[model samples]
Target chain A: MKIGVLVSEGPYTHQASDSAYNFVKAAIEKGHEIYRVFFYHDGVNNATRLTEPPRDDRNIVNRWSELSKQHNLDLVVCIAAAQRRGIMDANEAKRQGKDADNLAEGFRISGLGQLVEAGIQCDRLVTFGD
Target chain B: MFTSSENIDPDDEGGVIKKFMFVNRKAPYGTIYALEGLEVVLISAAFEQDVSLAFVDDGVYELKKGQDTKALGQKNFSPTYRALEGYDIEKLYVERESMEFRGLTEDDLLVDVQIVSAAEMADLMVEQDVVISF
Candidate 1:
């Protein structure tokens, strides 16, 4: 099955990010094709490269980055939502005249159209949020 | 950038046209869910899939007419419901119990929606391949 994931909340503050990560990892372990993982609303915070967690705690951002690197996952952050929440790639940062780019590795900024395409192309589109 | 298989016809895979239902359970203005839900619906329509909008609980209030969010300093996006038909997304189901509980009637809504019983709405949800709750 081709699975598309939609994460609507940020990490640490909510359990949504953890649940989505576990579900995506399990789905991949089961040999399912991951079409894309779309970050929307507060979920855009997951793609920031500036996160720093305690050594004892699980790093949700790093986990997603690892998954992307290992599986070649399409980690997409919604351009509109990311901009409002201040999550942008280098190109967007330059275009908008920002000081720096904080988009984490393995994640790219895109439009809501990508989410729509995921729903249409993937066999299953699962959403995790509050 | 779009993927290589972005244009693949859904039918070509297994002749399956997935039924996607956007379940609205939150009220507007207080949270971003309702407005974002509408945005997703409009975007999903471009893919030419079987999409439906279901309103239950406080979500039914999102369609109430005479909404003015000026005092709240928010944009009242209720009028966007009128544009759903333009996207060919006509299936709008509102829970009868929820509407009555909120002291609202079909006439109170700004757009056309079928008032369905809880059981009917459950059936509609069961028929969907994907249910995205907001």
Candidate 2:
């Protein structure tokens, strides 16, 4: 089955990102195709390359970026939500006249239409959030 | 910068049309979920799919009449609910128990809606291809 995932919470403060990562990994292992992983609300924080964790703790942002690389996943951060929370890609940063861009590798900024498209295109759309 | 076969047009002729339901369980204010959830509903209107919105729990407050956010310094978005009809998204369901619990009735709402019992709401949900809760 083709599946789409929506993650709507920030990392560290919430277990949503972790749970979503595990679910996506298991789904891929089980031979399911992941259409896309959309980050909305605080979930867009997962795409920030500036995130840093304690040496012993799991780095949620990197975990997502790595998995996205390994699977060639479409990791999309909602442009509206990301702007509200200060998550920006290089182009968006330049357009908004910001000092720097922090969008992590393997993730791209896009419109909410991507989320709706995921719902329409995928066989199932699963959400993880507060 | 990346493209693939998955990026097909949502409005493609003879394309799959699924029943997409947006479940709102939070109040309109005090949190961003209600506002952000409504954003998704508005965007999904462009997809030309069978879409519906469900109001339950504190979400029932979202449709209440006379909501003024001036004092809270927030955008009073209640009026946008009425404009949903223009987007062809007219299927709005409000749970009867939730409305009564909040001391609200159909007359208290700013827009027209179908009051559904919990069982009926469950049936509606089960019939959908995708249900997204906010």
Candidate 3:
């Protein structure tokens, strides 16, 4: 099934995003396609490219990037949510005149319309939230 | 969107299909999800689709009983959920595990809904042709 996942929580802060991450990996391993991963609310923090975890710990942000790289998945972070939380891509960082861009590659910044579109285009939409 | 004689299904796969599920996961007032979820349901219902909403995790607060938004400085949308039935969106489901984890029983909720197990909830998601989560 074509699936889109909403990650509104954290993988490191708690179990919600971690579970969601595992679900995405497992779904991909089972030969399902992930249409997109929509990050909203606090979920936008998952896109922060500067996240650096200990060597022994799981690098969730890197994992998200790797997931997108491996599957060529659509990783869209809500622009409204991302900007408000200071999560910016190259364009947004340039527009905001920020020193750095936190939104990693393989992810795009968009509005909720994309999420609505994912709903219409994908077969299933699952949410992982706090 | 208003209903008409002609067929219309915005959430339909190809034709004017019925039934759309919206999964909401957020506090009622803090995030825009609670309101957006209602809008989707209303709009889909106007398109003449069978609309059902599910609440999991913090989303369950969208249906907590005895809500007083005045203290939180937020508009009470709990009442809006009551109007869902008027829109023909009566199939509201609450995750049993979420309720249990949060210590919220049916009595603590704003409306009466079917309590679905984790596996059942997952199946319900898989059963939907179009599912949107917020």
Worst 10 residues of 1 chain B by lDDT: B1-10
What is the C-alpha lDDT profile of model 2 across B1-134, one tens digit per residue?
11221244557625768899999999999999999999889878878989999999999999999999999999998888999999999999999999999899999999999999999999999999989999
For every prediction, compared with the true complex, DockQ reads 0.35, 0.44, 0.10
Per residue, candidate 2 scores C-alpha lDDT tens digits across A1-130 of 9999999999999999999999999999999999999999899999999998999999999999999999999999988889889999999899889999999999998888898888877889999998
TM-score pick, better of 2 and 3: 2
lDDT of 1: 0.88
Name the docking class for model 3. Answer: incorrect
Residue pairs that clash (backbone atoms under 3 angstroms), model 1: none
Residue-wise lDDT of candidate 3 within B1-134, one digit each (tens)? 22121222344546445357888888888777676556556656645555678899898888998888798776777887887788777899999999889988899987779899989999987777776677
Better of 1 and 2 by TM-score: 2
Poorly placed runs, candidate 2 (over 4 Å):
B1-9
Write the number of the candidate with greater TM-score, choosing between 1 and 3: 1
**Number of the top-ranking candidate, with DockQ as the measure:** 2
Model 1, position A68, has a per-residue lDDT of: 96
Q: The CA-based lDDT of model 2 is what?
A: 0.91
> Which parts of model 1 are misplaced by more than 4 Å?
B1-16
Winner of 1 and 2 under lDDT = 2
